[model samples]
Target: MTASHELRLITLYAICARLFFITLIVSASLLPPFDSSHKTILPAADPRSLFDVFVGSLLRWDEFYFADASRNGYQYEHEWAFFPGPSWARRLVRSVWSTGGRRTISSLSEALFTGALTNCLTVWSARILYLISVECTGSASVARISALLSLLPSSPAVIFHVGYTEPLFNLCSYMGMLNCMNAKWAQASFYFMLANSFRSNGVLLAGFFLWGLIADPFLRKQKIPLLNCLKSILYAAITIAPFVYHQFTAWVTFCQDDGLSVEWCKRFPPLIYSHVQATYWNVGFLRYWTPSQIPNFLICSPPLLLLFWSSTDVISRLFRSHTQSGLAKQASMVLPHMVPHAIHAFVLTSWILVAAHTQIILRLASSMPFLYWSAARLILEQPKLGAWWVGWSVTWGCISSILWAVFLPPA
Candidate 1:
């Protein structure tokens, strides 16, 4: 089938599958949660109404924080852990649907409005990812397969049904990569900046700008030009501007009022994101390596392993000659364009493993299209293992939706 045909089919499948998954989660949310006593800002007790069952089902765990931020700005220090992109985006989207004269009326609830925005963004992201895969792999078949596999993400709840950052993040990240592939450096930097506004790790996306405008030419034995060097720095800085601005805002808000009283403000380059993650979430290097968190480690291992394997498989093949006519010859497919993405996945996976919350890889992994490529590769080369991967994604995605509804661990 053509790419357009595949996108239409994917759109249908995504809607149906997302509805099914939400049905299960909402059904479970109708029941009492597994633990009604979640620490750190979870709403106590079960959702009390039909509307609550639908919206509140997905609003468990950290979503409570997002819901709060949607109604209110970043008033609390811990609320700074979440970027303002989703909240701000939701407000913009809701305004489009607002009615009654001066457009002061909200036609929808916060959860409903956010879901409408994300549902469209996610389906559109699927198509963008398909195009990017085609650009990266030079094969419609690989792109189609990768796009299909991406529908069954390890964290379906975050992608389709929630007020989470990842849906917008995925769209922007894919757009940035696609723009970079097309040599649209300015547009690429803009999209990456939008991505960083959603997730703090989005600052790492500047590597794509650096790689495309700078590193790629150096690797090809081209003499470096001063113009390219200046362009690379400018674009990469644009991509990272959101993160730097985010920290600067926090400093302005907190440090100005209390200054040295805030412990994080006392340090050099006092970033509230880093401080909150470390102090509130215990997310420093090896801080999450406790025996009590073993289950979370196991839960997140599949994607982590897949990500590492995918990057290393491409990177290792870089050193080998591909003139021989066999698998070795095929190993170098789109190697140059993929170099940045593979490195991105590898470095980001390592960062998640060592320093960040390991379980978050399930949600964050979807932002990197390379993960789907790796899964596609497995299905093509090792059908048995790929079947297992598919089974695990479907099964665990359903289970996680339930866990989210009930407010269980691995948050």
Candidate 2:
């Protein structure tokens, strides 16, 4: 009906769905964790009461580091793997919450605070994603469908987890993308800067600045003004400044005097993020291609395939002379504005497939609106596959939530 009504509906749906997911996830704690050691993963994971299931159990996986960062500043070298943005948000919220700052997030008050913060971020992120989808597709119906699909994201566990980056990162990324679609370059840059502070790959968001300012104009053979060129340079620099500064901070921490003992410090440029990833997480080109990891790859295929196909669909439309009906018609209506996002999806999908942790695409892909939009396209034009995708999202989302609560694999 009306925009306000639509927003109200979205907010209500998000809240209901999130609560439902949280209910199932927390209830799953009745089952013992996959590993006995999970009891010690977080002090809160000790089966004391329902509060532990609801809040404490969420502090699994990378969240341990985040809880540490929020409670205590980055204390270890590997802690740099997590950007401080989400932790900073947690700190700000916890501070204003005016309680539970005495120790680690094991306290019930702190755990509740974490859930509230992440839930708010996620619900609002869905709202912003709807706005961005409408801007991109030029149809509220498409936007509505996409936003609903976003609610069934591939990793509800991680997205809803306490102290996880997905919630904050998705919100900032969508806000920035929405601003970009509205031609608000400054707003977009500021949000992009925030997104970069949460995830290192957020540097890739500079594509929007580059495409809007330089690449898109060049592709269309439109004359770019000198002022525009200067603005593009400035905006791009601003967008990537967080990532660059993150690297700089790492250098200062580990390189200046820590070099003699650290192998990564001696390397030219000395980026500790890369070193930490490769050394600690075994992240590199083809490194995860072993037999033991095939299941992980299988686990991550749907989003990666969606990203790959959707990105190619957009690029192919750019080259095709006409659009076909039904599925092709729905997919081939390429808005020039969407090109940069498609390119981003393609590049990121490629990177994750070969180099980064493939399984992360579940949660990582959530930050990209393109995935949801693509899923919407399938629902409209290719119902069978879309149904499968929806099934996968819901089934996997519930399972992963329990897996996360129990400190299971696919971390």
Best by TM-score: 2
RMSD in angstroms between candidate 1 and the native structure over all alpha carbons: 3.4
Writing each residue's lDDT as its tens digit, candidate 1 over 1-411 gives 777787788788778766787688778777677765332333432356676567555555666676567667888888889988877776676566564445543323555767666777777888898999999898888888888788788765544677688888999999999999999999999999999999988989989877877776765557888888898899889988888888999999889965879899999979999999988888899988899889889998899999898898777665453323322244535456787899999999999999988998988999999999889889888999999999999888888777777777654
- Each prediction's TM-score against the native? 0.91, 0.92
Off by over 4 Å in 1: 35-52, 97-108, 156-159, 321-334
After superposition, the stretches of candidate 2 with alpha carbons farther than 4 Å from their true spots are 35-48, 98-106, 321-332
Please report, as a residue range, the 10-residue window in candidate 1 with the lowest summed lDDT: 321-330
Instruction: Evaluate residue 193 in candidate 2 and report its C-alpha lDDT on the 0 to 100 scale.
Output: 91
